[model samples]
Structures are given as structure tokens and as C-alpha cells.
Target chain A: MADSFSLMQEQYAKILQTYLQEKNEIGLYHAQQFSKKVLENQISPEEVVSLHLDAIEKFFPDLPQGARDSFEFLLEVMMGYGMAYREHQSLRDKQKELETEINVAANMQQTFLPKEIPSVDSLDVGVISVPASKMSGDYYHFVKDENNCIGVAIADIIGKGVPAALCMSMIKYAMDSLPEQRLQPGALLENLNRVVEQNVASNMFITMMYGSYDPRVHHFYYSGAGHEPGFYYNYKTDSFEELYAKGLVLGITRDTTFREYHKKVEPGDFIVLLSDGVTECRTDEGFIEREELTRFIHQYKHLPAQEIVNNVFYQLEKLQGFQLRDDFSLIILRRKV
Target chain B: MSVQSNVEVRTEWGIVSARQAGRNLAKEIGFSSVDQARITTAISELARNIYLYAEKGEIIIEAVEEIHSTGVKHGIKITAKDKGPGIKNIRQVMEDGFTTSGGLGAGLPGVKRLMDEFDIDSVAGEGTEITTIKWNS
Candidate 1:
């Protein structure tokens, strides 16, 4: 009995040292369990020595079975805490990196988009393009080429992101090169389609609406390459006219032909161009339909060109449940007398 | 609730068309609005290479496991292969302003800088396969 008591004392002292060395409060909690074992005669002198050895192994924090036992389990809990802290820190770092990439990409895409419509006499124009991501696949541009031909395009690339941005650049350059393309919508689409097919992949395609407006005649000649129809409203008739001609998508098949549509805008006449993002928009009700869109346009017909554009976008934003799933693009042009 | 999914797109040109297809693929990958954009951007660059540089390829996107021992990232992996003109000098082609066609030359190099792991395999008169992986925290 005397020998056992003395050995237990030594073991207890050793365990206390481990708790201090490792600053393991949980270890201290388990030390009480060791003490109880002795009081209950559950631990023998040999077992006391083994417990002391375990305490020492855990002081270095590399005890393999260190955490399996009641005493070692406490120290293991502390180790878990430390590891979890490090893991959280690493995760935060990665999140920051992704955010930075998105910011830069979004900014680059923004530069490619037009912030404001060009100020043209006798023409009221407003446009909005929202990307489902930081960048989107839908591209719209308003350009007055070197020949002073106002070119407007609403193109939907087969996919989204930086690739769409790259493709948008391609479309801009191709249209610029074909400066002499006037009142020739079919030929213009043919040239653009050929360029896209040869330059891009055969599977990749673009559905675009390309048009050149002649300020002199107030006439718009437009070509469709599998794009959505544009609406032209004539105030004189108090009705809506459509500019839709069937054409194959660019890069689909090289020899695909395009159809041309012409419309003369009077002083109160206006034109609306949009990507499928608008027409295909969905909400809780169901897929946004074409007739519903016409109703929305007519509802806002009283507003000026820019105001109508803003109002239409506002309605779509609310109706689509505030989610811009695909690239949402819209352009409203009013002919000023 | 936000949902994320992992996808693998056959590097066929037909599948890549239609913005909805790519958009659906993006949403499935558990990407945030911003991550979705980066993912799409990365996909665009790689897909263009498959179509423009090679005749065919495949792209893989994987969702990262919450706890990974191998330190693997939770980003997408895109691999593309084509049997057209193999890049002669990878180093030169990796540089900006270096393009086989009259383009921005932002395809390969641009994708490399966007991801965590970027690899390439090519032989003259054969084809080229490029792989890129991005990570989410």
C-alpha cells in the first residue's frame, strides 16, 4: 500500500508537469480522471507510470494515440482547435483571390459596354445590357464608322464570359472593315457570317441583329442572323411594326443566307432592338413570352426613347424576379422630327 | 438558397452554342455571380482554343470537396484537344500579341493567368491539348 501510494504521487506530479508544459487545460480535466482511477483502485502502480509517460508524449503534441484516451483526448481537442483555425485562414485567402479576379473581369467587360447612348440629332436612343456574370455573352454596340454610317448590333454569342468579350471585339472589327456595306443587309450578314465561321470554331455560332441607319432617308436596313425580332412603332398609325427576317446563325454553316428588312421611321417612329436575353427572360409565372413583351412596350410607349428604355428594363427587372439569368440587352431608338 | 453544380462539356462546337447551355453549366458549378463570370471567361478562352486551334476537345468542371487532404482546389478543370496545327513554341505562343490568326492572342495565356494549374501537350502536325484548373475557397 505504501509503495503504491508513493508511485501514484509521482505519477500525479508528472501529469501536472505535462499540463503546465503544454498549457493544456483539457489535459488538466482528464488528469482528474486519472486521479479518480487511483481512488477507485482502478489503476495500479504500473498503470500510473504509463499514464505519466502518455502525459509526456502529449507535451510534444505528436502523441499518435495521444487523443484516443480520455487524457489524450483532451489534448487532441486542443489540437483540433488549432488546425481548424489555420484552415479557416486559408479559406479566407482563397475567397479574396476569386473576388479580385471577378472584379477585374467585370471591369473589363464594363469597358466594352456602352455607358451612355450617343447624342444624335433627330434620334432618341437608350440601351441597357446586364450580364448574368461579371461579363456576359450578349454584346451591343453603337458606332459611327469612318463613313459616318451609324451601326447598331445586338449579338448573342453561343456562350458567355471573356470568350464573348473576345468575340464582341471580332464583330466590331469585322463590321468596321466592311465600311462600304450600305443598304445591303443580306450581303453584309453573308460577309460577317463567313468571317465568323472562318475565324471562330465551326460549332460556335452567333445570333446577331446588324443594321445601318441612313440619316438622309431616315430609312433602316437591317439583317438578321438568327436573332430576335426588333419592334418599330409608327406613331402615325398608332401601331407596332416588326423587322424580322430569317437567317442562319453566324458560323453555323458557311453558305447560309440572310434576309433583309427595311422600314422608314417618321418623326414619331422609333425602333427597339434586343437580344434573346429579354425575350427568353423567365419569372415565377413562366417563360417571358413575345406577346407579353409587346404589351410591356406598348404600355411604356408614351415615354420618350431613353425613358421608355429605362422603364422597360425596370419592368423586366421586377418581372424576372430580380435575376438577370442570361445577358439582358435592350436598345430603344426614337426618330426625332 | 444558392445551388452549385459540376459539369463536363464535350468540346464539340455544337454544344457550346446557345448562351443558355453555358449559363446552365455555370450555375451548376456552385459558383457565385462573380465566380460564375470567371468560370465562363475561362471556359470561353479554352473552348475557343479547342475550336480555333484544334478541331475537337473536352472540358471538365469539378466542385471542390469541403475538406481535402491533398490540398486540391475547389475550382473547375478545363481540358481541350484539337488535331489541327500544334503550337511550335509554347513559350512564344504564351506571350501576348502572338497569335496564329489575327486575334487578340488572349486565348491560352489569358486562361493560364486566370487559373491555378495550366498545362499543355502538343506535337507538330498532330494536335494540342491544354488543361487549366481554377480553385474556390
Candidate 2:
């Protein structure tokens, strides 16, 4: 009986509150009818006053009395709540629209990239890529020509998100437009620099390591523009070698030059290319040292290329507490022993 | 720090992957060879359930450690989740001889027997999630 009595009291308070908030005649009429029904149920006038006072205290503590009419004060408060609620609703809708647009852009960017890694009978290729968010700053591309010479390019932009995604697509289009110049690493970098300097924003830059492998000559000619130095594993010596080249980052200056270096490729030699994400992985103590990465590569060099990449990724993920702070891209090309 | 892995079970290959992942995590956490096989069989059963009922789902493998007044205990936890037709009568389904999809009907009961802890939550129209844990002595 007490529960039913309090339930009716609460319902009456809600109806009165809604009438004041919405200023609708139907709500006011409903409130009047319910109050009449409460009186008929033998609820005393003192009990009604107490229930109303409790509702007022809980819903509006700072309501001023006598300085302004109670109804007028409620009108002001209701208008404020209505405006704030509308603003919140509109902001939520705008956020949802923005998220949908970003998803669309991400899907469009994916279409501009290669669907799968190209197959070359002489090279066993494996790649692993993970973006830090919806978009990535790292780029890896493979271009094969009629003569079976393959061009391998890996790059990292300075920034992230939509701008970086756009810059990567621009680089892909530039590479696709110039297959004739693919064999010359130095000249190709120069022409790409000109394109970047003219087209890309002045504040942005890209670091790249581009190499051309000629299966017939068993040689890899490469150029680097302020990019990470890749490692080469020699099967006979069981040692890792770093391939270094000196050059300036692209989109910086028009006259900057890139120098090409050549290495003789042998059977069982593996080329490993990666962005700084691999080299800068963090641990409890500090960033993992470069020498540790070198030793890790040598330890897992005997595994299939894909397994080596996955093991490294999982180990690094474990070290970093299962989170990646930046975009990661790794490519391994091995000549079968 | 703990080690974890995930396998999506939609095909026979996925069941194999979940089984292998369970065995690997068990071995890493120092579970005995006998316990490793038990863990593998339990995960395979869960993965098979996903493939047969939901057609697609995921299995998560985790390495866990708990420390208290007694000492430290290391264990492995496997969780299987699916958005399929939820079980209507959980009590009847848990019986050893009851079969819904008509095999030996021993999967869930055997899973409960093999692990130290087993839990399941299901909503009639929503989905189901089952988790099991095994500890190393």
C-alpha cells in the first residue's frame, strides 16, 4: 500500500515537471487530473505539500523564491535545458557524419594501392603492414617491368592521417607513370624529387629507400633519401650487412641529389626493409637498440620470410604491451638457396 | 606481462589454428604435456562449435598470472564468442548425453571436465560467450 502511494506521488511530480518544461496544455491537464485522483485516495494536504517540496529540492535546488514568480523562473530554466539538449543532439549527429566520411576516404585510399604483392619467380617476397589508426604513413610498393627487373620501394611520410594518405597515393601515381625510368635509381629519385617539390606542401617531406633488382645480373642497385638503412643477410657468412646511401629527404629542395649504391646478390641472400616503427619499438627500459634488431633478424633468418616477419611483429607487440605507437611496414625478399 | 593471441574460427583451418595456439600458450605457461593436450582438445571443441553453429566467431587465448597470500599461480584462459542462436535451455543442454546438432554431444560437458574453471552466458536472441581456464600446479 505504501509502495503504491509513493509511486502515484512520483508519477504526479513527473507529470507536473514535464508540463513546466514543455509548457504543453495536455501535460498540465494530465497533472491536474492526477492530483485530483491523489486527493480522492485519502492523501492528506500536508502529505501532498511534503511530496512536492521533496521533488523541488531534488530537481532544482537553486530556485529563487519570491524574487520572481515560480512559474516564470521555471520557464527560464526550461528554455536553457531545451537549448543545451538541442546543441548536444546536433553535435552528436555531426560527429557521426564525420566518422562516416573518414571511413569512405580510407576505403578509397586502399583502392589506389596494389591489391597484392607482385610475383617474381626469382624473388620470394613477404610483407607485413599495420597502421596506427584508420590511415597509415608508411608505404611499400613493387613495380615489375617486361625485362623481369623489379623495382622495390619503401617509404615513410613525416606526418599521419589524411594528408599522409594523400601523399602516398601521389607517390604511387608518380611511380606508375614512369616505368621507363624505373631501372635508374638515382635519376628516378631526382625526377620524383622535382615532382614532390612542385606538387607537395612545402612543410611536408618523405623518406624513401628505392632499389632495383636485376635477376639476370644478380645485382641490387639502390638509393636512399634520409630513409632507414636496410639489412642484408648473407647465407655463406651467416652475417647481416647494412645498406647505406646518402641523400636528402624529398620535398625539401629542388637541387638535392641522391646517390645510388650497388651490391652483388648471391643465392640465399635476403633483403630486409622496414620503417622506423621496427627500429624504435619501446620496452620497459627504453627504446630497443638497433643491434638487438640485427641479432633478432639473424636468429630468425632461417624461418620462411612470412614467419620471420610475424614472429618479429608478435615479439615487439609483447614488448610494447600489445600496442603499436606508429605505422609499421616490413618487407623481406629472399633468393632461394 | 602476459602473452595473448586470437584466432578467428570460420573454417577447418581456423580450428587447427585455435588448437595450435592453445597448445603453444599452454607450453609457454609451463603446463605439463598432458595438460597441453587437454587444452588443445578443449579449444578445438569450442572452435568447432563456432564453425558449426555461428559459421563465424573468434577465440581468444590469454596467459594469466594471479598472486595472493598463498603464492603465485600461472594459468591460461580461452574465451569463445559467437553471435548465433542462443541456447534456449542451458540446463538441459549441459547434460552429457543431450545432442542438438547430432554428434556425440560431448563437447561442452567434456570442456567443463577438462578445465579448472568453465563459464557460459547466453541470451535467447542475442549471443553466447564461453570461457575456460586451466592453471599450472
Q: How many angstroms is residue B74 displaced in model 1 relative to the true structure, after the best TM-score fit?
A: 35
Worst 10 residues of 2 chain B by lDDT: B97-106
Native interface contact recovery, all models: 0.00, 0.00
lDDT by residue (tens digit), candidate 1, B1-137: 22332233344543354123444554665654434444555676666666655656555544444456866444555556567678888888775446554323245655565456889988878877777676665
Task: Give each model's clash number.
Answer: 9, 0
What TM-score does chain A of model 1 get? 0.71
Candidate 1 lDDT, A1-337, residue by residue in tens: 3336456656676767867878878878868787676746534233344455554664556755633355433432333232233333444566899789878877876776666666667677778788877777888877664555577888898777777767876776776688553546688789888889889866667899988777777888888998888888888988886768688889877898887777887888888899888888899877888878878888988777667777888898899778787788888878887
Off by over 4 Å in 1: A1-68, A74-92, A114-116, A145-149, A177-183, B1-137
List of clashing residue pairs for candidate 1: A122-A336, A203-B13, B4-B28, B4-B30, B5-B28, B5-B29, B5-B30, B54-B82, B75-B134
Candidate 1 falls in which docking quality class?
incorrect
lDDT of 1 at A190: 92
- The Cα error of candidate 1 at residue A8, in Å, is 33
lDDT of 2 by residue, B73-97 (tens): 9999999999988788888767544
Alpha-carbon TM-score of each model against the true structure: 0.54, 0.56
Residue A329 error, candidate 1, Å:
0.6
lDDT of each structure? 0.68, 0.79
Q: Give the poorly placed runs of model 2, Cα more than 4 Å off.
A: A1-86, A179-181, B1-137
Model 1 Cα shift for residue A324 (angstroms): 0.9
